[model samples]
Target: MYVTQASWKSEIFQVTVGFLPDRAQIGALGLVVLAVLASWVVKLRRRLAYRRAVRPGQPVHAARYGQGRGADHLGAYAPQPGPDDTRA
Candidate 1:
């Protein structure tokens, strides 16, 4: 009788831990999502901190191109006001 009971208990344990445990899968997926979300949050925080360290009223041209003559050509794409401007 003791041997029969031990066999039953082993079978039960095996089934409980078998393939496709809903709770275990959910827990594992939740951990993966949490890790990805944490990494994204840290990356965004670093970007915002860098943006803040830049002084306000600093022209984008000065910061990026260092007052080069490229700023002269930067406005070449500016659209001229057309006769249809007042209609909008």
Candidate 2:
């Protein structure tokens, strides 16, 4: 009617281990891992193919930054020009 803490812990451990997966479950887990690896391989192949298709020594088109007047408006630390400022 009254179980000690040690015995109760052992009982819980036995129940937990009893619920562990069998060989079939382990095989299913392996299959899932293989599926994920295959997906990553396919993605890597596509990325490699795209990189190969791009010509070497050609500049990749990307947005140019800090070229416009708004570049100075980024932070409070940036210097703000006044109407009377004459720095050319």
Candidate 3:
């Protein structure tokens, strides 16, 4: 059994002193460093996974860049006619 500190000790000093809990102080530098390291690890893992998924000489995002904007799909889609001829 542990004895807790009294709220008010002295009768003469009847000041309102509530509960005070003992706690360990931690520095922000360590936490910041840890967070930064975790973020870096996550980024590295993502990079490695991407590399494994997309091998060399292969398009990473074929759908996005293969036949992107202004790409004529085998004459299936033609570019919209520009305003009047460029002879103006």
Candidate 4:
């Protein structure tokens, strides 16, 4: 009789007595949801900050690829003549 009463008082029994998800499990799930929402908020804030930081007239990739006329000297729009091509 005393052993049965002790078993009833165990941590597993107490936690699983009635509800599907106990308070601790619920709190854990809540923490996971909160973390996801916090990550989303952080990502959104970072994107907004990046958007605001770009210069008004410059293309977004210009800084990474090299900006303005100097950058275009070797690209598609540059002169087609190669230095090694000899036409006598």
Candidate 5:
């Protein structure tokens, strides 16, 4: 089957124009975006509330503070023993 360039161009234009969103579709998309934004705001508020609830003087768990081996309670890196160091 042989198709001309003009026919292809017309088909492309028709597809593009036909797929253009209507008012209802645009409104629905706007609502979805607003809902997502509202949910994110709610989550942020909840996180802020949690932070406010926590006391500054409260001691945190040692496991929560450390990363790898020999890390201090404050998540700071501590020096590991070398082969030359005789101290056990």
Candidate 6:
């Protein structure tokens, strides 16, 4: 098979290449779908594994804090005041 390169001085050749249908477009879409499915399966497996790692009646945070639920067990989402904040 002979391979030909487009020329910079030719306007007709540029138009031909510009209008050419991309054959790999379907393959690229398939690859993207496969990747998304793989990621979803991985995330689901992780969640199932985590559920298996815990027993009934066990607090979800017990492993991290080594303690059961309490009023003081504020999670990481607890708000913090910024240095420039003027609120009391």
lDDT on C-alpha atoms for all candidate structures = 0.68, 0.73, 0.57, 0.67, 0.69, 0.66
Candidate 3 structure quality by residue, lDDT tens digits, 1-88:
9997655544222232212222211334356569989999999999999988877776565456555445445366766547984521
- Count clashes in each candidate, considering only residues at least 3 apart in sequence or on different chains: 0, 0, 0, 0, 0, 0
TM-score per prediction, in order, is: 0.39, 0.40, 0.34, 0.40, 0.40, 0.39
Write down the TM-score for model 1: 0.39
* Pairs in steric clash, model 5: none
Per-residue alpha-carbon lDDT of candidate 1 for residues 1-88, written as tens digits (9 for 90 to 100): 4553458866765565566478985776677689989999999999999997785986564435445343345686745547976522
Candidate with top lDDT is: 2
Q: Model 6: which ten-residue window has the lowest total lDDT?
A: 63-72
Q: Model 5 lDDT vs. the true structure?
A: 0.69
Identify the superior model by lDDT, candidate 1 or candidate 6: 1
Q: Can you tell me which runs of candidate 3 are displaced by over 4 Å?
A: 1-26, 56-88
- Regions of model 4 farther than 4 Å from truth: 1-21, 55-88
lDDT of 6 by residue, 1-88 (tens): 9998667655664454556466655565567689989999999999999998885886574346555344235667645557895643
**Model 1 stretches with alpha carbons more than 4 Å out:** 1-20, 57-88
Candidate 2 local lDDT, 1-88, one digit each (tens): 9975668866775566557678755676577689989999999999999997785997776657745455355778767777896642
Clashing pairs in 4: none
**Sort by lDDT, top down from the best:** 2, 5, 1, 4, 6, 3
lDDT, residue 66, candidate 4: 43
Which 10 residues in a row give candidate 1 its minimum summed lDDT?
62-71
